[model samples]
Target: MEKDLKEYITPPIMLIVVLLAISLMFIFPVLNMIILGAILAYGIRPIAFRIQSKLKFSSISILLAMIIVLIPLILLVAYISFIISGFLVGFFSSNPNLDMDSVISQLSTYIPQNPFLDKNSIVPTIQSAGKSVLTYLVGKLGSFANITLDLFILICSVYYFVKDGDNCYNFIKSFVPKEYNDFFERTVESVEDVLKSIFYGHFLTSVIIGIFGAIGYSLLGYPYGIFLGVITGILQLIPIFGPWPIYWALAIMDAIGGNYPRVIVVLLFGFFLSLIDMYIRPAISSHHADIHPLILLIGFLSGPLVYGIVGFIVGPLILGITYAILDSFRKELQESK
Candidate 1:
């Protein structure tokens, strides 16, 4: 009777149970880090191997490789923080009160027929909101000690993962049933492709954008140009509307600073950089794997919603594996039929 009842259970129910069991076993705390580390290790493994071959020692090579990858990231964050702090200090110390009378005078002249000429109330509200935002930012930065510690932990985790990646990969591969080992191996390859393509491609593109932006902004003699450029490049990583916002922001800043020529120059440069994503990303990404652009788009959009920042890496990987597994199952079912 028990056997018959088990047989009667639906395939969907069985699949659900299997998924739950797998998640419970593999999606917990260390598993996520292990998986992340493995993917990272795969991307750097070739370089690590090259270094090892040349240096005749794996440990020193791995350490050097880690430094190569990590130091730039640390420097970028530190530089960005310094620039932001400098900007804030200058802005507050100046304490230049908004010249409402002058603004109203200009507005009255520009729009003679407009009835919304009262600037007193609106100006105060805008000033109040701006101050509030500045205060919030200061409060957040005041907790930098905790933020620094968190960053240290993340760096340590990534370092260890890079150091012990091969063993982790072998451990994961061992769990696959012998009959399905080939499929398991292919899945791992697919994951490596996805990780290398997404992580490295995104990193390279952001850096390029940031470099060009800083150069352009400096040429135009814009204050905090490098800082804004870094921000623009980071924003460009967003799936959609990334570059446009940065361009508009720079244009607005230029307008406020009464630098129309600089505004025009920045706008043109931003337009050029914005359009390069399509060509640049595809070129790098296609070299690794042939994931559908639409799937990648969805993963980029949904990743953060699901797994925070790490979701950007995890979401696409999960989707890729899902596609492979479903394809395999479909073929097997067809063969049985």
Candidate 2:
């Protein structure tokens, strides 16, 4: 039976419209989960495949990969959470040694007197504001349900992305016209390169700095050096201002506590790490994505402000692809002329 052209075109057109409507309905999610999942899938795909070759089971290989990747992440998050909770508990407790009156007096010294505002009233005003914020947040505890749902979605998206990423790519590519397949392929390669450079580049640098920081802190006799180093390494994901503030803050505390020698040592090690950031990151990432560090830095800063945590990854990815696509389009036009 010969189908009419309307029959051939109508289904696909309707399917596309339905998909578009569904996407519009869920657009509030921002698809950060999928983007993150894709990046993770791409990074870990080779390792997963190699493991599968040895094991002769894709499912088991994927399980092993997930364990390898997720366990550490879970541990890190748990550890940070513990540290934060402990700090908060200690801070809020009414320990006799805390001496809040003296602390308030010390804080008061920093506030300059203004003609419009009373110097004595500033601390109470800040305290009132803090209490109001605390109350507001305490009332919002119910919102944790939403955060949990988002995390669940993220985890599931990552799992599926890893499992069916290749199939999904093919499915998407099938929609492209054959005449533009070459351009599409080129764009994919370009985007892939940029993602690898940014994501893997940050990952590699973070591990290096984290390990180095751990070793340095341990040698310098800093307490909980490994934990602090781990945190430091994680913070390296922030560009231009990676982990320096933490080190500086620690050094200031140590100096105040009369550990001048230790402070100097920490500062020197931090400076060395800064050099690695300046040299190694650019050297590795430039081969694939020769973008300015400022682009990434701005992305990290403004991404969180706009799109939340996922913006850190997506911001650079979006900027890189936008440029690459524009360049490819220009080339295609020039060639046609």
Candidate 3:
């Protein structure tokens, strides 16, 4: 009687303790940093294994994985920042010699008037909006210092996650009932497949669209084409808005410049890019994974609403893993039957 009581009481108590601890973990900002590390570790697993195979040193293998994964991201952001900085420097210049009124006067005739449109209204609004953005960015520079510290924490977490990940996995697995261990392992793998599918699938599509945007803009003789293209590419990952604004805005600018034919060409190019995202993304994503495209669409749409930028990843992951667990239960029921 005593042994049975202890057995029944211990599992529930431990489970409750774990759930409480996890709830507490969510209240800390460090959770986001840890999640970021887990994602990087998971995404770089293939590279990490290859490095391990060559070096036979777990620490070196993990370090190489970190560098391989992070350096490209750092370089891309740095390049984009440089481009944006140059654009801002030019935009906010208080050059007394430059004649804004004269420039506005020359371009105003080229703009076709509509029922709600005043010829001079749009350019001044644009100028004012640009100044407002510049002011906002100047105010946000201090927040960037805090972001730098978060980045450092993220890097350290990722390093440990990559190096100690397997050990951590084993430790967690040790907690599972021996009878359910195999099912738990399968569930874990299925969840991992979902994550990899989402990351690589969106990543590939974004890069392709970015290149297309850059090429299309360059052919159309648009200034800062590469910068706009990068922005479009980043936005492509978001489900609700994908390059529509960039292409449409550029098409309007072309129309304003009296280049109607070029406007049509820009629209067509943007349309093609959109179609690639709609069809090609799911094809690559579902190749090895069983997840529906709709799950991803919902994730991309809802994740940012709840978790800010990190929600983009965490939201879908939670949904996918939940599905996997349910499916595993179904499979076990069938087997028992």
| Clash number for each model | 0, 0, 0
In candidate 3, how many Å is residue 233 off? 1.4
Give lDDT tens digits, candidate 1, residues 136-170: 88997998985676555555666666677767778
Candidate 2 on 1-68: residue-level lDDT in tens? 35776676687788988999998779557477667767777767777888989999887787788778
**Candidate 3 Cα RMSD (Å):** 5.2
Model 2 bad stretches (over 4 Å): 1-15, 86-102, 111-118, 132-140
Candidate 3 residue 253 C-alpha distance from true site, Å: 1.1
lDDT of 3 by residue, 1-337 (tens): 9998788778779899899899877637666667777887787777988989999997888888888877988898999989889877887685647787678667767777767867658688657877999998787685897678778888888888877788999998998999998888888877778777777678788888899899888888888888889989998887678889899998988999999998999999899889888887877887656776577678777877876677887777777777778887888889889
Model 2: worst 10 consecutive residues (lDDT sum): 27-36
Candidate 1 segments whose C-alpha is farther than 4 A from its true place? 1-35, 96-157, 256-258, 320-337
Model 3, position 2, has a per-residue lDDT of 97
Ranking by lDDT: 3, 2, 1
Give the higher-lDDT candidate: 1 or 2: 2
lDDT at position 297, candidate 3: 76
The better-scoring model by lDDT among 1 and 3 is 3
Q: TM-score winner among the candidates? A: 2
